[model samples]
Target: MANKYQRILLKLSGEALLGEQGHGIDADILDQYAEEIKAVQAEGIEVCVVIGGGNIFRGVKGATAGMDRVQGDYMGMLATMINSMALQDALERKNVHTRLMSAIRMEEIAEPYIRRRAIRHLEKGRVVMFGAGTGNPYFTTDTAASLRAIEIEADVILKGTRVDGIYDSDPEKNKDAVKFDTITGDEVLNKRLNVMDLTAFTLCRDNKTPIIVFNMNIKGNLKKVVCENQSIGSTVVWDQ
Candidate 1:
């Protein structure tokens, strides 16, 4: 379990939660994620999480359908909360200590996000699940992940995606898409790589937060990326 990073922010898309199902969560995937995360936690790396809501709802999609943009975003945020709660339950089932915090106040469901409290939980070896994207309209959970990582001084952001890593083009569509073992944040922006949103990427670039994009759906990939620092994904950083 040797590693350089002591703390990390892991961002999972809600679509990933859906697993093989057309909609909603897949119990098997949740169980797999829980086991992978448990392995990382056993290595003593503090973990923080931010999950997207595209699987359940998407604000931008709703806006396109003529829904009020603000209302749509609020619904999206709530969707993230649902995903977070599901993840929390899965982790707890594996006996992993976790704290579900929310950007928007939801005293009934989760703790209001407090910097000190969140950090304390990490210090105490509790995984912190941050739900509710930025508590505002027009902000993606990607931005929330970046903001929280910076706030908590995380060493890196582990962007768990369906793809193996960042590539010159969509790997699924383009068999010729070239993968970068390592890339600079500026290069990602210059090439308009689809690793994350511009706002999220810019925040990481400005804060010098290194990001590792890997396929979390693959069993043991999380532990390999975090604990072993194995060459399993594309790494984006401020400097090479």
Candidate 2:
């Protein structure tokens, strides 16, 4: 089947890497994500990824614990690099071509982030993993994902989480919470749904980038969404 999106940016949470572990990454989860990504790439969709660092460290949590905000954020960035490297290794083990790029300079490990180079890599069918969260102290990886998606003109942002989709209330807590299969960006903002942070949401809203929130733990769902264009998750758009 032909892909609905030519290019996509996948946003994954660091906590998702925990995969039942107390802390740190789970090798099984890494391999599962790689396999999912490989399936999508095999369908000829250009893919890029941005992962968070909550499993290893979270800047906001550190700041609340009395650590300096800037220092905490930098530490969070490094944590993301660790996850990025792990995912890169998994993808390579599957024989998937990939490039690890970081906002911060670390020539020994990853290539510095270059917009054109990233797009070029995608054009060449290489999966690109963006790390270090924009190299800024205040921004979250969500913001980084939005920024990168816009810069690269990705067709959509796939937010892979444990939840199946966005809900009117917290599904984990509210038994009666309602889920919308498709929603306008304005509706998300008006309802104050906790999708992405405001900065990240605003960037996507202004750029008219669509976001799909889905359960990444589900096997074959990625391919179903990208390749089959099935409504396996909730989709956020500027308009219906």
Candidate 3:
């Protein structure tokens, strides 16, 4: 089956890597994510990823605890690089070609992020993992994902989360929470659904970039969403 999107940017939370562990990454989760990505890539869909660093460090949390905001944010960025490298290694072990690019250059580990180069890598069937959260203090990885998706002209941004989709209320806590299979960007904002930060959501809203929020922990869910176009998640669009 033809893919629903030719290219996609996957946004993952670093906390997702923790996977039943108290802290740090779980080997099983890494392998599962690598396999899921490989399945979608095998269908000829271009994939790029941006993962958050909350599992290791969260700048906002640090700032509240009296740490210098800028310093904490940079520390958060490095944490993202660590997660990205781990994911890259897992993908490589599965024989999936990948490139680790960083907004903050560390030539010793990852290539400095270049727009054209990232697109070219996708064109050659390589998965590109973007780390360091836009290389700016104050911006979240969600914004980084949106920025990269727009720069690469990705068809959509796939936000992998623990939940199956976006809900009217917290599904984990509200048994009666309602899920919307499709919602407009305007509606998401009006309802104040915490999809992405305002900055990230605005970028997609202005650029007409659609977003899919799905459960990444489920094996084969990514393939079902990207390859088969199965309605496995909630889709946020500029218009319904």
- Best by the lDDT measure: 2
**Arranged by lDDT, best first:** 2, 3, 1
lDDT of 3 by residue, 71-144 (tens): 99999999999999999999999999999999997999999999999999999999999999999999999999
Candidates in order have lDDT scores of 0.93, 0.97, 0.95
Structure candidate 1, residue pairs in collision = none
List the candidates' TM-scores in order. Answer: 0.98, 0.99, 0.99
Give a tens-digit lDDT track for model 1, residues 103-167: 99999999999999999999999999999989999889999999999999999999999999999
Tally clashes: model 3.
Answer: 0
Candidate number that wins on lDDT, 1 or 2: 2
lDDT of 2 by residue, 1-240 (tens): 568999999999999999999999999999999999999999899999999999999999999999999999999999999999999999999999999999999999999999999999999999999999999999999999999999999999999999999999999999999999999999999999999999999999999999999999999999988999799889998963
TM-score of candidate 1 against the unseen true structure: 0.98
Residues forming the 10-long window of minimal summed lDDT in candidate 1: 231-240
List ranges where model 3 is wrong by over 4 Å: none
Residue 142 C-alpha lDDT in model 1? 94
By lDDT, is 2 or 3 better? 2
Worst 10 residues of 2 by lDDT: 231-240
Model 1 spans with C-alpha error above 4 angstroms: none
Off by over 4 Å in 2: none
